[model samples]
Target: MASHRKPRGRSAGIRTTPAVGITTAALTSVALLSQSAQAAPAAPTAPSAPVEPSLDEVKKKVDDLYHQAGVATQRYNSAKEKTEKQRKKVDRLLDGVARRADKLNEARQELGSFAAAQYRTGAASETATMMLANDPQGYFDQNHLADRLTSRQKKAVDEYQAEQASATKQRTKAAKSLKTLSESRDDLRTSKRTVQRKLGEARALLSELTAEEKARLAAIERKKEREAKRKAEELAREQAAEAERKRKAEEAAQKEREKEREKERGGGQGSSGPDTGSGPGPGAEPGSGATKAAKVIGFAEAQIGKPYVWGATGPDSYDCSGLTQDAWKAAGISLPRTTWDQVKVGTTVKTADAAPGDLVFFYDDISHVGIYIGDGKMIHAPKPGANVRVESIYYMPIHSVVRPA
Candidate 1:
């Protein structure tokens, strides 16, 4: 009965034990396990299958290169367009000069023919014809009309002379113009060559960068754009705030002036009131520095119609410094001819202390200048894509302020 009980108890223990039990002996002998007891050798690793690049990877690279090529093509097209435009302008100028030259030559030839005809039918020839006439009385009567013939011949000669002179002058001018046009054409050709070379370089460079790199660069560019836009909006807000402050200041000054006038009128019956001239009051006078500055502002206003010139100092066209010099000169004040020289001609003033007609310098190297026109507005000959015009002070970089002598 004890043997039967032992067998049952062992059976019961076996039944109670779970199937997943790692005995100490099994764990110790894992490294030396029998082949049948071990796992199936990781299924032979499938030989690693030497993977060629995927279709998607090739497509991605191709797509990146294609986009780069497109960008390069677009740049090429833009350069071609610009070159063509400039070439067209040069052609037009040359054609106009040639046409004027041809017209002048034709006019000269026609006038020459008229002069020759008049000379052939003139008084001397007519007198010779009348002397040889069969009727002597008819000859005398014709001779009496010699004075009219002489007058007519003189008038024709004078007109021909004037026309020849004009034609010669026009021809000379046209020749000069053609020379200049030829130079411009050469320049355009050089520009076209340069653009084509740059386009080739761009295309070559496009072949080098990989798809992943392109994506990474694009991400960076987008981030830069967002940052730039944020900065621009911030600058714009600051400008708006400055403008509001100036408007309030002007209003306050106007109110003060009005109140002062009212008090003078109401408080004095016998006193003659302040002299109010439509012209500059006692605050402005010739030779006065501040008054001269006001006149400079007036001079700039007068030249609102003048065209912008890149490097001109002018009776006609002007760049930034050119316009400033001309405006100040018009107001009987002399300033330097260049922006750099002009920068040194005035007393340095803070931006807040800058008044109307103060010279405003701009840019990292001070490449631009403008005359402050009060209330945060300034007049300048702006950059290449712009003209001599009035703009907000906040539109460009403001380096410093200078008050003129």
Candidate 2:
């Protein structure tokens, strides 16, 4: 009130601003911040596209899948073989069970006839008779007719019971064997499907590559083949050298033994007919094994261009183990249907001691098998696309060598 009256510029010590002025300033500041925020740009985001694998990586992955497929294929082949064998066994068991059932029926008919004859004679049932007779000996002695009838009836009942029991046991065994055969058949189908699926995946992956990539992959394979050939040649040379060294060492040992024998004979010359020692003579012909080997090699060579079919054992197409099994079969030796079983059936030999017709297994799983054909070479039906052909044994990593013949 005092300031309203008259002081020009210095009316009161403190002056208060209007509320509308403070609100207007705050609103203006908020409007300016909103406008600035609207005008500012947003931060950029990173890319979201996925990176593709290189051709080499794809090839490697496909190769791994192919190898896995090969393993599954071998498993399928093994299961198929087992299923076939089990089916045969089950058939034989069923036949035996049928025969036993027939015998049981005959025995039961004989027992029934005896029971009927006893009933016609006004005799009690065998069970009732046995229960009623406190002294069986006295009862039979008093009635010789009953004694003869009961003795025959008792023998019939015993035979019938034994036959029934035997038939039942055989039926139970046949049922279990049939169940196992069914399971093996199912397993075979599963393994087959697994192999097919893996191979399909590998094929699809390979099909996705460009022509240039395909060419590049082919070149890589060629290089590998060349390297394998070089290694095979070197191995052949080393084997020859080793064989020569062994021959010289053996010759020297034989001469030393001959010298010892001569000295024992008072320095007189011994007869030089031939060294009748453990080893073969210098001019001895190759053994029958060599003939069998030749036959195996011949059979394998005859099937040089056949297609490779998984789980196949035939004169047409063959799998890795199938080709080997059939080849040995041509030489009059029977081999199991799969490599896993075939490997166990034969005598294991060293790689250096491997002869023609020897089964050379490859990979750590022993999924692949080929017939060794000398000169560090083997005949094999390689993977799906490959034909039965001769290649270096060292083309793949060797697991072991087995001689089936």
- Top candidate on lDDT is 2
Tens-place lDDT digits, model 1, residues 186-205:
65465445544544554555
lDDT (Cα atoms) of all candidates against the true structure: 0.63, 0.83
Cα deviation in Å at residue 371, candidate 1?
0.8
- Alpha-carbon TM-score of each model against the true structure: 0.35, 0.77
Q: What tens digits encode model 2's per-residue C-alpha lDDT throughout 113-145?
A: 766666888866563343246654455456653
Clashing pairs in 2: none
Candidate 1 regions exceeding 4 Å error are 1-282
Residue-pair clashes per candidate, as listed? 0, 0
